[model samples]
Each structure stands twice: as C-alpha cells, then as structure tokens.
Target: MPLAEFDSSVGHSFGLEFDSVLIRQITEVSGLKMEQDVIELKQNTADGKYAIKKLPGRPKAGEVTVTRGLTEDNSFEQWIKDSRFGKMVSARRNGSIIVYDYEGMPIKRYKLINAWPKSLEISTLKAGDTSVLTEKLSITYESVEVD
Candidate 1:
C-alpha cells in the first residue's frame, strides 16, 4: 500500500508508497504538470480515480483532458468533489490543492491533491529527481493516474 504525509514546516511530509510501475508513472506524470515549477499540498481519492496536481499557472493553450464515457457529468463532478474522498481533492480545490482537467466543451474536471514528494521535508525535497522519492516508492497498478 502507498502512504503519504504532510509536515507543514519547510513544506509538508509525504509518505509515497508506490510499487515499481507506479513509481515510474508518477515520475512521468509529475513532469506533466501543466505548469512549470509548482507544488501541490492537498490530497483526494476516489474508488478508481486518483490525481495529485500542483496549483500553479493557468491552463495553457493545449493541455491533456479527461471525459466520462458512461458517467454523468454532474454525478462525476460530484464524485470528484465528494467531501470525504474529495476534501483536499475537490474539483473546486476550494481550499486545498487541486488539479483541473480543462479541455474541450463542458470541461471534464477532477480534483488534484499535492502528492508530489518535492513537498516533503525529509530527504526528498526536490521534485521527482531524488532517489528517496523515486527508488523508495512503488506502484501497484499499471494504469494508476499520476496527475
């Protein structure tokens, strides 16, 4: 199981628990941050969806997008904004950190928490460039989303 924490000083503490593949995905995804150099500090989780995004910069000209095939836009939005699992992950990012998938009309959106190890104060202070964040964490699923 993957685990992460928040410290609050020098930044927060994140206990990243990724297998092997997941570790790779996160590294690749973290690099996908629509923005350049930003830090995510919140978190949120759903049954099958997970997003950890940095809150910086607006949606550039071209960005990746996600849409629901069978899920209703309102319901899916509600799911991503769920209080328990969507606290810091709310699509609103109202108070906590969040990731917005704004592409196309209606714009399918999800929540983004700060799941990056760069936010940690331990040894992993840099983005996904440190050994502690990359070598230590592992991924369980092959399709696990990194945001």
Candidate 2:
C-alpha cells in the first residue's frame, strides 16, 4: 500500500466485544499483553567455560483492564458477581478488543480466551466535580490471540 493510502488506526477508535456482542461506551482499554517466564540454565562447556543459556518457560496468564463511563447497565457487575464464590466456571467468557480504521471498520482484533472478571472499581465521587463517572473492570484470561 502506498504511504498516502495507509491510515493507522487511532487508539481512541476502538471497541470491546463479549461473545460477539459489542460493548458500548468503553472509554479506555489497557494491558492487552502476553508474557512468559524465562528459565536460565548454567552449564560448563567442553572448553571449561561457564555459560548461562536462557530458555522460554511457561506462558503467564494475561490480564486486561477496561474502563467505561458509568451507566445503568448492570451486565458487567453481574459478571463480576458470578465470578465470586466458586462460580468462575459459568462466568468465563470470550471477548475481543477491536481496533477500527477511520471509516469505523474493524482493522485488527485481539481475542481473549476463557476470560473472567477479576475485579471492579468505581471512580471516586465528589460533590461539584465535573469528571465523568466511570467504572474500571479488570479481567484475567488464559491467553490472548491477535487476529
């Protein structure tokens, strides 16, 4: 593609979807990352030199934090509640973070597998404050796949 024809998607132009249903009013999304532990092995070479070899270990579980403007929707709260007290199996969900182009078409997607809400936080409220009320939800997942 020509440089002039290329349009990188902006960070603000993104959305979240759970089980293919688009979540509305998502103001921010962070921590869409994958990581793994490193294993190091120290050995003596035939030349009697000590060397440390690094190897990739088990993959770490991924976590993502999503923030949205507070609203009457109680679905997320319900999901968080369901994850408590050994109800995690039924609360697990698959979702995606979608990035959109300038025309509002999905250009990239990061799929979260076997995800569940880990925590929920509401922004502090104060009298006479003009900030938008928001809730932040932390989700933990087995893995993330870019599609």
Candidate 3:
C-alpha cells in the first residue's frame, strides 16, 4: 500500500473578501477564534451533599485584525467611517477569509457574519522613512461559521 501525501496550507496564501467583493493587498490576518462562557451552578442533594456544576453559557466571537499596506483606495476607510457616522446598517457586511493550498485552491473558509470595523489605525509616519505605510483594521462580528 502506498501512503498518501499531505501538504499544509501556507499562512501567507489567504484572501479576504467582503460583500462578495475581494479586498486586495492584505498583508496579515489574525484573531480567528470562538469561545463559550462557563456558568457555574450550586445544588444541594437529598443527602445534604453539595455539588457544583459547570455549564456552557453564551458563545463569544473574537475580534479580527487585518493588516494591509496603504494604497490609493479609500473605500475601506469609508466603511469604517460609516459606523462612526450613525450609518451602521450600511457599515455592517458579511465577509470571508479563505485559506488556499499550494495549488492556489481554497482549502478552508471561515464565514464572518454581520462584520463591521471596530477601529482603524495607520502605521506611524516619520520624515525620510522609506518603510511602506500600513493600516490595521480591527473588526467585530456577530458570529463565525466554517464554510
């Protein structure tokens, strides 16, 4: 019998898209996670024995941080501004982070639900500095599903 070969997807080969439109020049992405809160219950048994029970409470989705090089485009900044300007309905969007294999095929996809930019930060500016300027966008979402 021949053993099957396996190849892991690279972290740099991922793409982000929002509202069916692709976002370009993404340099890094982080904070893809979900967790549940724990609830504790105390009860007294018939034999006068005390017991403590732990239960799962509500689920929490993590805030995602996306880093990209600054460009001529200002659309992403506009989206962030919408949230601050009381245009929340227009700011909320659905998005996905897709991880691709070495062959450029999608291997894993995480769907972001009702996502909106929570904060936006730009890289520090200095005179005569040649480093590429970047922007970090922190996004909050209602939930995440594997697709």
Candidate 4:
C-alpha cells in the first residue's frame, strides 16, 4: 500500500506535488527550463529483419560538458591546472554533478569517475557590456553513474 496527500477542501488528491504556481511564474518571467540530460541509443537490423546479425559495437561514453558562470573565486580553473601541470603522471579527479530542485533538494546526480577536462572555453569580452563571464568545460571520464 502507498500513502498520499489528499486535499479534502478541494476534493482532490496530489502525488509527487511540486511548487507549480511558483514554477509557472518563474518560467513566464525568466523563461526558466526544467530538464534532465538523457542519452539513449537505438539500433536496427538489416537483411529483411530476419537474419540474425552480430550486435553492434558497444558505444563508448562520450564527453560530458558543463557550463557555469565564472566568478572571482574560480575553483574549476585550479582543478584543471593541477591535473595537467608539473606532474610526472597527471592525477585524475573523480566527482559528481548534482542537480537540485527549487526547494534545495538534490533530484539527480552524476558521478564522473577519473574525469579530466578536455577543453575549457571562456566567454568573450566586449566593451560597455554587463554580462557575467562564463566558462564551458568538456570532461572525459571513464564512466558515469546516475542516481
């Protein structure tokens, strides 16, 4: 058996309730988007779909990209430099990227094992502009776990 919250006054039941009113307002004003990254693959067989064919080659995990606003205190930059500079064998860093809900609760997390930045791109600067600088990082990892 399962339990749920019921609104007797409104004669309705709610399951997995979220702050929809607040989310709608934010979306309308700021165009906020709620999404999660999902990667999938599909394959098809040849020979009139009758002949048994060998399975396709396993797909290697591709790079995972992360982008964030650059602040005065930059930690990611340090990680990149430490991993690649002044070392006999560069050390690999393992970490996770977690996405949280509006209520400040983690909803999804990805574990990046043996990860290193493949590329980093800094935002372009222009005169008379007030946009915060951003950095883009493409990380290569041995594996990824979602939870």
Candidate 5:
C-alpha cells in the first residue's frame, strides 16, 4: 500500500457508539489497556542450577476514558446517580469506540462490554476563557473486544 493509503486509515477522525447512539462530539478516547499476571516457578537444572519458568495467570482490563464537549443532555450524570442509588447493576451498559478513515469508514473498533461509569468530571470554569466545557468520563468494563 502507498503512504497515502495508510495515512488515511490512521486518521484522527473517529466516533463513540453507545446505547445505540453515535456520539460525534467526542474529542478523545483513551486508556484501553489489557494485562495478564505472570506466575514464576523455579526448577532444578541438570547442572545443579535453578531455572525460572513463567506462566500466564489472570487477565485484567484497565479503565477506558472518553472526553467530549459537555452537552445539555444529562444521561451520563443520571447513570452515575442511579448507580449510586443501588441501581448499579441496571445502569451498566455496553458500547464501542470506533476509529474511522478519512472517508468516514470504520477501520477499527474497541468494543466495551458490561461497562459502567467509574468516574466523571466536568471541565473547570474560568472567568475569561472562551473554551467550551468538556466532560471526561472514565469507564470500567468486564472485557474488551477488538475488531
């Protein structure tokens, strides 16, 4: 493939899909990390030396963060509020963050399953600043599927 072709696919344009809705105002999505535990074992060698062996243990998914311009809709806030009021199980949701090409086609997608809001922060307000208010949402999910 040519440089131009690869460049387009790596473009910054992307979308966040959740609750059957596409959030186009998202400015950034990050913190998709996966890690596994390593179990080490020591064994006796023929030369009277000890050798270490490593084995995979458990898998862990890190938190995912989504930042976007603050909107009038209070859906995210409501979900957090509900979760705090003994509705956490019901408030959990599944979603996906998709990276798109210059032509607006999806090139990659990170699917979030059984996700729920772990934290939400509204941008700080300044007297003379003209920047728009943005909300940062951190989510915790059971698993992540990449496609």
Candidate 6:
C-alpha cells in the first residue's frame, strides 16, 4: 500500500460508533445517553460547565484495560495526555487499551479534582471528535466492578 492509502486509514481522518451496552454504562454514571454515531461532545461547556458531571470514587492505584483497536497508534496517547485526558500512570501498554481505574479496580473512586485525571473514560474519535472524561464512564466503572 502506498503512503497515501495507509495514511488515510491510519494517522488520518476519523469516524465514530458508540455501542449500546457502553452507552447504558455511561448513562448510569452520567445520566446522559450517547449514540454510537456520536462523533463529538463537549467536556467543559462553552459557559464553563462541565459537560459530564463529576462523581465520587475510592482512592487507590487504578487499573485500565481495553481490547486494543487495530488502527490505534501513538497519536491516541498524545491526544489523551493533551486534552481532558491527562497523563496516565505511564506508557500505554502495547496490544491492550488500558482504562485507568483505582485500587486494582477498573474505576478508582476519586473526586474530579482535575477533570481528566478523575475522568473514567478518555476517547478521541476517528475524526477530530473526542469523548472527554466524564461521569458516564464512572458508571461504567461501577458496572464493570459489579460484573
């Protein structure tokens, strides 16, 4: 494949999709439901309102896990650290998409002292869209804990 073709698919444009179960989990945490095709949403409102309200969580070393996406690259990490998703524990583990959590759990309970740091989910869409850290992901944190 030429550099152009590969670039288009990788390190290029973006798309979006939100699974049902994931939406529910977010809704439980955030009180709002996001559709799969949701390409973008705000984290901090235009008027300075936090898009996804913060919630409480226990404090401890968290755990982050994910079924790595094929097209994923270092850009994802850059975006994570740049935007609302602040610096994580360290380097993102290869072959796996880790979601930070607490005390050996997927969602470490913590007050949103700093949004992204406290955010449960940090996602940058295929395009320029982004799913900032919010309460919905925190619900996912709790749900995953239950399962």
- lDDT for each residue of candidate 2 in 1-147, tens digit (9 for 90 to 100): 221356555677788899667984789998889899999999999999999999999988989999999999998899899998669777899889898776677778999999999999999999999999999999999998899
lDDT of 1 at 98: 23
Tell me the whole-model lDDT of each prediction, alpha carbons only: 0.27, 0.88, 0.86, 0.50, 0.82, 0.28
Ten contiguous residues with the weakest lDDT in model 1? 18-27
Q: Would you list the clashing residue pairs of candidate 2?
A: none
Model 3, CA-based lDDT: 0.86
- Candidate 1 residues lying further than 4 Å off, grouped into runs, are 1-34, 37-64, 72-75, 83-86, 89-147
> Candidate 6: misplaced stretches above 4 Å?
1-58, 72-75, 81-147
Question: Candidate 6 on 19-82: residue-level lDDT in tens?
Answer: 2112111122222121122234448878887786445444433322222232323333443454
Which 10 residues in a row give candidate 4 its minimum summed lDDT?
22-31
- Backbone clash count for every predicted candidate, in the order shown: 14, 0, 0, 0, 0, 13
TM-score of each: 0.17, 0.91, 0.86, 0.58, 0.87, 0.18
Report the number of backbone clashes for model 1: 14
Query: Which 10 consecutive positions of candidate 3 have the poorest summed lDDT?
Result: 1-10
Candidate 3 wrongly placed segments (more than 4 Å): 1-7, 44-49
Candidate 4 lDDT, 19-74, residue by residue in tens:
12111111111111223444444455564454434444544554666655675644
Mind sharing the TM-score for model 3?
A: 0.86
* RMSD (Cα, Å) of model 5: 2.6
Better of 3 and 5 by lDDT: 3
Model 5: colliding residue pairs: none
TM-score of 1: 0.17
lDDT of 4 at 130: 98
* Alpha carbon deviation, residue 36, candidate 6 (Å): 34
